[model samples]
Target: MSTEPTASGHEAASPAVDPPAWLQRIKSNYCRVCGSPLKLLKPDGEREWRHVCGSCGYVDYHNPKLVVGCIVEHEGKILLCRRAIEPCRGLWTLPAGFMELNESTAAGAARETWEEANAAVKVLAPYAHWDIPVIGQAYILFRAALAPPYTFSSGSESLEVALFAPESIPFDQLAFSSVSITLRLYLEDLRAGTFRLHHGVIDKRPGSQPNDPGAFVVRDHMALELGGASATAAGPGVQEQ
Candidate 1:
């Protein structure tokens, strides 16, 4: 049997449920380091409250896991990969995966590019940080220059890899809203010779509510606004939406 992952990493479709508790909960659980019920404090200009470990003074913020990928350019074509596993199996997308612990985000992006497309890339500039709705996943995009023409790796998570021009991008086959929106903005910037990298959030979770507790939404975009000298060689620390 052909093993192909469905969209967004899972084979089955996810229900349009409420946003994740990870971001919605105003209070976090008791801290493991300190055997005490953590204190909740909503930081200024942010959504969810932060959990402060009273005994240890460990402030646990509601930060989502980050995954980074490269939008690689080679011979006037952009590299694309077909996800072999879920949440978006068989869909076309750029090479991307989660950020591993103890590694820099830039390194993680480069690694995912190599693993997914079998392409070596040099990170050029930062792209956008996207928060996938409902799924509670965050992605960081990077502008990269492909080392050469790439072939698909026979991995457990990819079917094939190919390249396409900007006008020929497969919108319907993209993995998620982030991928689609990033491509659109990138293409526009590429044509206009203006690189206006945006710092915002895109909520794709299900349900619609202002403060109904379960309604999906993204907030506190100041994290992404860290630009200029404040942005380190490691790039901005944009938590997933």
Candidate 2:
């Protein structure tokens, strides 16, 4: 789509940190493909350790999960849902969820919007792509508009749903940094009359040292030149769910 300056800014890399507990649990557990115990091994020319099955030779690739969402705007208000699940219960966030297999990212975004808000939206172009290595989730966000009628209800995953004006967004109580960042950029673009694709990384490694990097950093994709690194990198750990 549009290539305008983003209000949310870019994320930068910092000192490497420890993985999350959920990922550690998966690494210590047995293989899912087979009932065999997993062992750490450097496969072929790889630098880091990988979980390999002793009996079945299954290799567990710790990849970032794909999460899809939509920025559903009706009139001038944006839709937000109060999370009913753990990790961030009762917190407000955009309509988003883990992407299922056999579905396109756009379709998944639309599905999540409908599931979380019970609202129909016309899925538009991809808007923001966030690489959340600490949580092992790569978020693909789409820019969408509310379809006709603009009625909405809270789905099972949401405790409640409502539309909020840009100036009234609850930034302090957002469920995730990605959601906050996306909304900020969207609001800024709305004011500037331009919307651009945003790419950035968010690291949420727990117990990080103070002198270490902050929880969030956004890179200037327009100014910096990436040699050839994939936007989504394989982080140190993996999460089962």
Candidate 3:
């Protein structure tokens, strides 16, 4: 995807256009405003799809979600937490979470760190990012850094938290492939004393049930998506790993 630097000079990924036939399905089945069934339209726009419902005027746009996380290092070791939830229970991952409303992206990242690891951190510049889909929700990822000498505690979703040296990273114990790749990249950067930001697309659309065109679901709060990485494949049952 071609990305142009916005006014902030941050590279923004170009939007992807879904199949036009899907747009037709959306226009015919969903009301432009409330996403309810559109009953009538005297003259629908030909160039653009538009339906104004008497109840509401909700414009639907395919928006990608933003996520954030940090690669916290201490004493030549990186921090990871074992998950206690489904999808990849008993697997290790970096501390991360979703961004909440009324909060900056960095603040959300910090909050997730505090919630998951009980550690405070300072937001660093962008590191790595990837576009991925979970069920139906699209996401973006950001890599950050943590302040040093912090202690971690087990959270509601975490079974345990600990730090591991680069050589001792537990690959088989990683919850998601994204987590494994992130750690590998981080260690590579550490060895070279250089950091590089990368972005890619990972599609994980679920299997379609016969005759259920509008059936869609999204799995959130996976460590892999913390900052926009694909946690796992889309299947009938979406889980962590």
Top of the candidates by lDDT: 2
Q: List the residue pairs that clash in candidate 3.
A: 33-58, 87-240, 140-228, 141-227, 141-228
lDDT of each: 0.67, 0.74, 0.57
Error of 1 at 75 (Å): 0.9
Q: Give lDDT for model 3.
A: 0.57
Q: After superposition, how far is residue 127 of candidate 1 from its true place, in Å?
A: 1.3
TM match of model 2 to true structure:
0.76
Q: Give the winner by lDDT: 1 or 3.
A: 1
Which digits, one per residue and each the tens of the lDDT, describe model 3 over residues 1-241?
4456686454433233423343445445565556675433323432333444545644444445676666665656777888888667888887776677999876777787788888877665445564555332323334444565567788888999888878899987786545566677666655654455655544343454311323332122222222333221111112223
Per-residue alpha-carbon lDDT of candidate 2 for residues 1-241, written as tens digits (9 for 90 to 100) = 2446444332322213543345456745588888889876666875445778898988888888999998887767888999999768888999999999999998999999999999998875677888876667899998778887779999999999999988999887888778878888877666655566678776665654311335676554332222322221111111112
lDDT of 3 at 210: 15
Q: Positional deviation of 166 in candidate 2, in angstroms? A: 1.5
Task: Give the runs in model 1 whose Cα sits over 4 Å from its true position.
Answer: 1-62, 132-134, 148-154, 207-241
